[model samples]
Target: MDKIQHRTIFVNGINMHVAEAGAGPAVLFLHGFPELWYSWRHQMLALSSRGYRAIAPDLRGYGDTDAPPSSASYSAVHIVGDLVALLDALGLDRIFLVGHDWGAVIAWYLCLLRPDRIRALVNMSVVFHPRNPSRKPLESLRAAFGHDYYICRFQEPGEAEEEFARAGTARIIAKFLTSRRPGPLCVPKEVGFGGSPHTQIVLPSWLSEEDINYYATKFDQKGFTGGLNYYRAIDLTWELTAPWTGMQIKVPVKFIVGDEDLTYTTPGIKEYIHGGGFKRNVPFLQELVVMEGVGHFLNQEKPEETSAHIYDFIQRF
Candidate 1:
C-alpha cells in the first residue's frame, strides 16, 4: 500500500485526489459509491507490477477530493467532465478504463460522450442502459421496486445519513461491504437502516478489518452525503442525458457481474444481458462474465479475478 503514490490534480473546478502506481500504459480506475481510490489498491499494485500505470481517483465528493454542497453538482456531466479533465491534465490521449458500480455508470457515459479518449473498457457491477426519452430513471426504479427501495430511499436528503449515523459509520461500512443479499435493498421508514449491535458483519476472506477501518475513517471524515448525492441526482442525469437517447456505447468492452449482485438479480437484468439487448446497445461488447456466488462489490471481493479480467481484456486493445 505504501508503494502507491498519491497526488492531487486540479480538474473541472475541483481538486481530485489520485493514487498511481507503475510506469507503462495507463489504466484508469473508477470506483463505486461508499468507496474511494483505496478500493482499487490491490488492482493498482498488481497492474503496476505488471508494467502498467494504474490510476485511481477519489473523485469529487469522496475521500480527499472536494465535495460540492449540492446534489445538482454531482450530475453525470460534472463527474465525466472531471474525468476527461483529469485525463487531459495527465497528458493522456487514450487509455484503458475500468469502473465498478457508479464508476461503471460514468465510464459508460465517458465512452458515449468521448470514445476517442478510451482504448477499451472493462466495467463491473453496473450495465449501461441508454437514456429513456419517455420516463426518468428514478421513476422507473420506483415503479419497478417501491418507494422503500434503496435508491428511492436515498432520494430523500439527510434521511439515510441520519440512519447511517445511528448505525455508526464503521458498522454501516461493515454491513454494506459484507452484505450478500441479492435483491432490492429496501429501508422502510418504520424499519430504518440501522442494524442491531449484536448482528456483527463477518468480514469476507477478501476484506480485512484494516480495509474497513481505512474506508470507515475516510467516510468518518467526509461523510456519506457526497456519495449519496450520486443517487440523489439520478433523475437529473435522466433529464440531462436526453440528448444521448438511443446512442449506443461504441467501445470494445468486457462486462462482468456477480450472480448474487442485486443488479444481476434485478427484474429484467438477466434478460437484458442474455437477451441480446445489452449487446444491441453496446455493439462492441466483446465479453460477459457472471461469477457464481459473487455480490455487488465484485472488484473488492475478487480482486485477483477482477484484475485479471481487466488485464486480459484491456491488454487485447
Candidate 2:
C-alpha cells in the first residue's frame, strides 16, 4: 500500500488538514459529522495503492481545521464553496467526489452549485432531498423525526455547545468512537429518536478504550458548537438552493445505505422521499446498494465491504 501523507490546504480563507496519497485520478473524500479525516484511513490507503489519488479533509469546523463561530458560515452554499475553493487551491478543475453524512449533504449541494467541477458523486448514508420551501419551520421537521430531531434541535445554538462541554465531551466522543454498529441509542429516546436506551446498547467489538480516548482528546480541542453549526443551516440551505428546486443531477451518482439504517424505517418516509424528492433529483443516478447487516456507520463497521463497493463503482466510471 502507498504511504499516506498529511498536509494542510488553505481554502475559503481557512486552512484544512488533509490526509492524501496515490497517483492517478483525484478522489476527494468528505467525512460526516462527529468525524475527522481519520475516519477515511482505510479508503486512503486502499485507493492510493490502487493508483488512485485519494484525499480526505478535516472540513471547516472539524478536526484540525479552522472553526469559525458563525452559524451562517457553515451553510450548504458556503460549505460547497469551500470544496470548490479547495479544488482551486489544489489546481484541479474537476474530481471524483465521495461524501458521508453531512459530507454527503455538502456533496449533493456542490454538484448542484457547480456541476462542472464534479466528475461524479458517491453519497453514502444521507440521501439528497431538496429543501421544501413550503414546509413549516423547525417544529414541523422536529415532528417528522421526533427525538431523532437532534439535528433540528442543534439549530438552537448554545444547547449542543454547552452540553458537550458540561457533560464530559470525552464521554460524548467515546460514545461515537466506541460504537461499532449503529444503535438505537445514538440519540435520545425521549424525543423518539432511534436506538435503545443508553444502557441497553452494547459497544461494538471493534472499538477500544484507546480509540475512544483519541477522539475524545480531539473533541477537547474544540467544543461541539463548531460541529453543531452544520445543523444551523436549514433555512440558509433552503434559500440558497431555491433556483435548483426541480433540477436533476447530471453527474453519475449512487446512493449507498445500510438496511439497518433508521432512515429506511421512518414512518411515511418513502412517500416523502419519492414524492418529487430524491427520485426526482438525481436523474443520472446509477444504483442504490443496501447492505444487509450494516448500519449507519457502514465504513467503520465493514471497511472491506465498503471499500470493495467503492472500488467497484469507481472502476465502472
Question: Largest lDDT belongs to which candidate?
Answer: 1
Tens-digit lDDT track of model 1 for 99-201: 9989999999999999999999999989989898988888888898889999998987898999999889988888887777767787687766656766767
Best by TM-score: 1
lDDT of each: 0.91, 0.74
The weakest ten consecutive residues by lDDT in model 2 span: 189-198
Which digits, one per residue and each the tens of the lDDT, describe model 2 over residues 1-317? 23888888888888888888888889999988688787787888887788899999888888888999998888888888888898898888889888887888888888888999988888787777765667634656776666555676566688666656554665666555444333322355342322233544345765556656666677688666777888886677777778887776789987788766655445554555556456667878887777887766677777788877788788776
Candidate 2 TM-score versus the reference: 0.88
Query: RMSD to the native, candidate 1?
Result: 1.0
The C-alpha stretches of model 1 lying farther than 4 A from their native spots are none
Backbone clashes under 3 angstroms, per model: 0, 7
lDDT of 2 at 106: 85
